[model samples]
Target: MTRRPYRDLVIFARGGGWGVDRAADGYDPVAVIRGTDFAAVRSGRTETVPRRWEKRTLIVPRRVRPGDVLLEISGGSVARGQTTGRSLFVGPDVLPAFELPVIPASFCRLVRFDTTLVDPRYAYYGLLDMYLSGRAGDYENQSTGISNFQFERFLDAELLRVPPMAEQRRIAGVLAALDDKIEINERVVTATEELLRAEFDALAVTGHGSVPVTELVEFNPRTPPPERAGAPYVDMAALPTHVAGIRSWSHRPPRGGSRFRNGDTLLARITPCLENGKTGYVDFLAPGQTATGSTEFIVLRARPGVPPQFPYFLARDERFRGHAVRKMAGSSGRQRVNAADAADFRISVPSPERLAVFGERAGAAFTHMAGLLAESRALQSLRDALLPELMAGRRIRPAPAPAVTGAATDDAGSSVYAQ
Candidate 1:
């Protein structure tokens, strides 16, 4: 088959290298792979780091200009066309990622379709969804894992046989609208959460009313045995931001690295991430469900009036994490937080009436946010389901296979996605 020459389109690397941040996974300011900004940047690490990149930055070539295509050839899993989508600006810091010889830009037809078919930002987020979709599995392990999409395969599987340019544009447009809404809704949720957290932080209930966590809660640690399989397991990756429940699992729950009952709080006791807000309250679990996590968490179990949702807020609270850090900074073996330090950390326990009011209101807000987030994810699923087909000219707004039934969803009556 004669291929279209993409020689004229501008191409650049996509993912930032993980090397700089490997030493400190949580807060490496030198590389963006683990930085604080959940928002994507085109180049340079967003955090302030003492060490600067030895090589070039991550932006695009001056000749190609800003509107040119930004293709990410090598990334998390090195197949091909791993990053299949649209990008515009080339951030300066992104340059160093392409210093190696084995990696190639020309593998997957990385072209700059610098036209109006897709919004660059929307396409960027879409590409991320593609990458994150396969996070269930480690890098390339498949059986129970989702394999990463390399750029080469991406071209063969995605780039080579896309639908007519017009249809690609249409599909991209529809998907962009849904993502745009999702982004807006997410921003609203963040702002609401910030407002609530700020109010909780400033309340005049810190002094005499303060009590040690050990008084009202229990610190129980479980160690994972040599055995690696049996029951479902909760890897660190399973923990998401603001979760009060565990949804995903990888290995079986270990014999005992840590334990948590429903409504217990799980705080990552390690560095960087402990600072990055990686705590969650256990609100939902199946009947007799027992999941274990990496030895990196301090499970907070309340005695009684310590409203269940309170852990959710305290987990997000800077004060709780601050005490957690000061206590662990001097620790010896494996950087773990001691149960006594947890006991030393203090928080004001308001009257049960006040806590009940706070917990009920906060929990309701969390449920609402979770619902919205769940809906956004479902919309994303719909978009993904249609992408390959629509881009391949196999599906469209109106159906071609009239009355044929499958997992495909129409404009309305879509399946509600949840665990």
Candidate 2:
């Protein structure tokens, strides 16, 4: 194994060339990926944002290639923290029909690897490990409130230990196997959600009746924190843009966040986050448990006869989101949705019998999706635990599949690791 400056492995690392021109939102109509889009990619979820609705852009536009790795460049957190340094590689699975050269916004940078010198997949996972391990954070420039990483400086000062190409491939394959199952499970969850949405659409067509959101659900209900500290706390980031559930949180002093109990839906009401679709259903907490999160959240809980999942799906719907975006009022960066406007928006309500039926179906589907999400978390834990050991030259194959799959052999007569 040999060590090399991080820069020697890349052909070019540059910031995005073009930005969203606010003046051209409708006129430009160009497809673009921004720092916000990274949230969807990171969560293994896909969301469609109309080109005309994206915020103002920079004049320069940098086209993305399939193999290029996109990294967030501007944010409060730097290279080491979960708040920043999120990376996603552009590939066929992510953009199968990517015909036109989609531009990257200024807040993102594209890093192209020299595949002849390194395996791209291996490099991606390696970078991920570095970030997770906090090794990458050592190179960050922390002169201001936001942590920033300069690629040129990182390449010059940082050293990457390169394993033999064969080992790199093997390491990547093992890790990717875990990721493949996670992705597969995510796809299943997405499909289930789409079905539920279809049912909602159908119910809307029948026109049982309609009521304002406030009439059907509680808005920002108050849940005063316990006299003590260390309650579960969730920031905006914990609520993913398109993911079905929250996978992370912290225990902190009860302070300054919208409070809610289990089964509540937390929908981001601020500019970029709202526009990006950051919403999460609260199921991770124990029964009767209460938690608080960024005040930017609008807490919605179903009223009597309404399914617990109703508010979650309603917040996730495109129409509701579009309406919220339209009602946002404020300065360029500080815009927020007017709570009154949101509460006043009319939502179609089904008849009691039909509502109960839809509730059962949607509840069943969500329960299954939550189970899959839990399994994916376990697989991710295994992959993360194995990554460092594999990168350090420890030769160990993954343990044979547990009886989870109900069979010892896969379709090819090999032992299955997972379904």
- Which candidate leads in TM-score? 2
Q: For residues 274-371, what per-residue lDDT tens digits would candidate 1 score against the true structure?
A: 76567775644454555566677777765677656666566666566667777775445446567667567666767667667766767787776666
Best candidate (score: lDDT):
2
Alpha-carbon TM-score of each model against the true structure:
0.62, 0.80
Q: What's each prediction's clash count? A: 27, 12
lDDT accuracy of residue 238 in candidate 1:
54
Error of 1 at 309 (Å): 1.6
Error of 2 at 357 (Å): 1.8
lDDT of 2 by residue, 197-253 (tens): 888777772233366677678878767574365678888878876656787888887
Q: Cα lDDT of all candidates, in order?
A: 0.47, 0.70
